[model samples]
Target: MKVGVVTFPGSLDDGDARRAVRLAGAEPVALWHADADLRGVDAVVLPGGFSYGDYLRCGAIASFAPVMGEVVAGAQRGLPVLGICNGFQVLCESHLLPGALVRNDHQKFVCTDQRLRVESTATAWTSAFEAGAEITVPLKNGEGGFVADAETLDRLEGEGRVVFRYLGANPNGSLRDIAGIANERGNVVGLMPHPEHAVEAGYGPGTDGLGLFASVLGAGLAAVGA
Candidate 1:
């Protein structure tokens, strides 16, 4: 399977995302924000970064990028897409996913090894993880808080769309300790934590994040019979 990792102007983790895809036994295709085409990749990843310098708001501008036009269309048709950190914000801005990422309640940028509970294993990006499993991954962001209306939050909780929940501390003050969430169809996912950073053993907490990439590749290949 071919996974595309998009690199915006100030994207920081596209390389890591590509590496993670390769480590997961998939070919990593580099994509640019200005390009509308996806280069025939089976899945797409919007890596974390300070795109457009995080000017007006995180991911506000990148949501309108040319490539995201295709991403939005693909996601609606059940394409698998994972958005990390600022990319998560872009997903919300694009309305592909619900909720918004706001400033951390502490009014400071936070970076740490965060513990997350796998709430759902049905999504393409999280199927490799066992439900209710706890895993540690790197979390870094200035505006990582997740917020949504009461009805939307209740619906997400009731429908099992909340994919990951913070285990110990509510690092960013996300509602209901939500660290990540999936779309209704389970094809699209957005999260504040950086899974790509934890795919390797020596670099991060452990290989816990490898499951995310593997899950996407495995699911994509299965869907396409590749």
Candidate 2:
């Protein structure tokens, strides 16, 4: 299986995402933000970074990038897509997912090993994790607070779209302690945490993040075998 990691201007974790994919036993393909094609990868990951310098509103500008056009279309077609940190902002900006990420309630950048509870294993990126499992991963961002209207928040919770929730304390004041969420189809997932940074042992928090990459790769293999 092959997973495509997108690299946008100022992207910092594309390499880490690719490495995570390779570590999960799948081929990693580099995707440029300016490109119009997806290279036919089995799944796609939007790595964390300040795309386009985060000029307009976090991921506001990068949402209009040429490559995102294809990503949006592909995601709508049931292609698995994972967005981490800044990439999560991009997903929201592109309207592929709902809600928005705002400045942290503390109004400062935060970086730490965050504990997250897997609320739902229905998404492509989270299927390997057991429901209600707790995992620690690195999270770093300035505007990582997730916000949505009451209806939207209620809908997300009611529909089981809330994928990951903060375990101990709310790191960024995200509503309902939501660390991650998925689309209606459970194919597109966006999270404020950096799972890629935790995929390797003796590196980050631990290898807990590997489950996300493994989930998608295993799903791709199953599809092919089917």
Candidate 3:
């Protein structure tokens, strides 16, 4: 499987995301923000970082990049797309996923090893995890809070779209402690935590996040076979 990792100006975690993909037994394809192509990769990853210096909004500018056009279209076509941190912001901005990520309730940038519970493992990006499992990964951001209207929250809960939930304590004040969410089709996912940073043993928070990449690769390969 080939997973494309997009790099926008000021993107910090694109290299880490690519390494994680390679460690997951898949080929990592480098994609540029100004490019209109996807390089024929099977899945896509929007890594974390302060894109465009987080001007105006976290992902507001990055969402308008040339590459995002293809990403939005690919996601609509059932191609798996995982967005982490600022990537999550971009996904929300692009409407590939719902809800908005705002400033942390503490009004400060937060960084720590966050504990998260696997709320729904049905999504392509999270299928490798067991429901209700707790895993720790790195979390860092200034505007990582997730918010949505009551109706949208209700729909997400009722539809089982909530993928991960904060455990122990809410790090960013996300509504209902929602750490991650998946689209209705389960093909697109957006999360604030840095799973790619936790894919390796010594370098990452732990090996707990390797499953995310594995899950997507497995799902993509299975879909092709089916």
Candidate 4:
């Protein structure tokens, strides 16, 4: 399998994402923000960073990048896509996922090894994790609070789209302690944590984050089998 890791200006974790893909037994393709081509990759990952200096909003400017157009269309066509940290913000700004991430309730940047409960394994990126399993990964962000209207939140909960929930205390005051979520079709996923940072043994966290990449490799890009 070939997974594309997009590198926008100021993107910090693209290389880590590629390494995670390689560790998961897949080829990692390098993609640039100004380029629209996906290089025939089976899946795509938008890694974390302060894109466009987080101007306008965390991910607002990056959402308009040329590559995102292809990413959005591919996601709609059932291609698996994972967005981490700032990438999550971009996903929401692009409307590929519902809800928005805002400034932390405590009004400060946060970085920690966060515990997350796997809520759903239906998404292509999360199939390797067992339902209700808890795993730890690094989470760092200033505006990581996830918020949505009551109806949307209810729908997400009812439909099992909530993929991961924060364990222990809330990190950034995310609604209902949500740490990650999948799209309605289960192809696209957006989360604030840095799973790529946890893929190696002697790393930020443990190797728990490797499951996400492994899940996509096992299921391919379509979420139907995942």
Candidate 5:
């Protein structure tokens, strides 16, 4: 499988995302934010970083990027997309996923190895995880809080769309300890923790994050028509 990693201005983890994709047994394609095309990759990853210097708001400016046009369309067409950290903010800003990311409860940048529970594995990116399993990944951000209206929150809970939830401490005080969520179609996913950072053992807490990247390539996807 060929996975494309998009690089927006000020993107810091695009290279890490590419390496994660490659390690997951897929070809990694470099995509520019200015480009309007998706290059026909099977999937796409919007890596973490402060795009446009977080001007206006985190991911507010980047939601309007040229390549996001194709990303939006591809998402509608069932293309798998994973958004990490700042990229998660971008996904919310673009209306690809419901809710909004705001300032952390601590009102400061927090960085640590956060333990997360795999709540749902129905999405294209999380199919490799066992439900209720716990894994740790790097979480670093200043505006990583996730929130939405009560009704929406209830719906997400009822539909089992909450993908990843904080296991031990709520690092950024995200609602319900949500670390990640998936769209209604289960194709687009937004994760606050940096899974890309944990793909290599020597460089991170563990290789626990590899399953998310490899999930898309898992054989069970075709059985479910993913």
Candidate 6:
């Protein structure tokens, strides 16, 4: 499987995301923000970092990038897309997923190994995990808080769209401790944690995050019966 990792001007973890994809037994396709094409990749990843210097708001500027146009369309067609950290912000800004990410309650950048529970395993990126399973991954961001209106929150909960939830403690004050979420179609997902950074056992947080990448790869291969 070929997974495209998009790099916008201030993207910091694009390389890490590419490495994680390769480690998960898939090819990583490098994509640029200025490009409008998807290069025939099976899936797409929007890695973390402050895009456009987070000027207006985190991911506000990047949501309008040329590459995102293709991404939005691909996601609508059920092409798997994973957005991490600031990339998650972009996904929300693009309306690919509902809700908004805001400043951390502490008003400070936080970095740590956070415990999360798998709330839903039906998404393209999380099928490998069993519901209610606990996993730890690196979490780092300044504006990582997730927010939504009561009706939207109720719909997400009612529809089982919540993907990941904070386990031990809420790191960013996200509503209901939601760390990640998926679209209604389960093809597009956004999360604030850095799973790519935890794919390698000795290098980053740990190997706990490998399953996220593997899950998507497996789902893709299954679709092709490979």
Q: State the lDDT of candidate 2 residue by residue for 172-218, as single tens digits.
A: 99999999999999999999999999988899989999999999998
lDDT of 1 by residue, 126-216 (tens): 9888999999999999999999999999999999999999988799899999999999999999999999988887999999999999999
- Comparing 3 and 5 on lDDT, the stronger one: 3
Per model, state how many residue pairs clash. Answer: 0, 0, 0, 0, 0, 0
Off by over 4 Å in 1: none
* Per-residue accuracy of model 5 over 113-223 as CA lDDT, tens digit each: 999999999899898999999999999999999999889899999999999999877888899899999999899999999999999879899999999899976733474
All candidates: TM-score:
0.98, 0.99, 0.98, 0.97, 0.97, 0.98
Q: Is candidate 2 or candidate 5 better by lDDT?
A: 2
- Pairs of colliding residues, candidate 3: none
Stretches of candidate 2 exceeding 4 Å from the true structure = none
lDDT of 2 at 115: 97
Q: Report the candidate with higher lDDT, 1 versus 4.
A: 4
What count of clashes does model 2 give?
0
| lDDT to native, each model | 0.94, 0.95, 0.95, 0.94, 0.92, 0.95
Estimate, for each residue in 1-226, the C-alpha lDDT of model 6 and write its tens digit. 9999999999999999999999999999999999999999999999999999999999999999999999999999989999999999999999999999999999999999999999999999999988999999999999999999999999999999999999877998999999999999999999999999999878876888988899999999999995
The alpha-carbon lDDT assigned to residue 80 of candidate 6 equals 99
lDDT score of model 4?
A: 0.94
> For model 1, where is the 10-residue window of minimal lDDT?
217-226
Model 5, C-alpha of 219: deviation from truth (Å) = 6.3
Query: Can you tell me which runs of candidate 3 are displaced by over 4 Å?
Result: none
167: Cα error in model 3, Å: 0.4
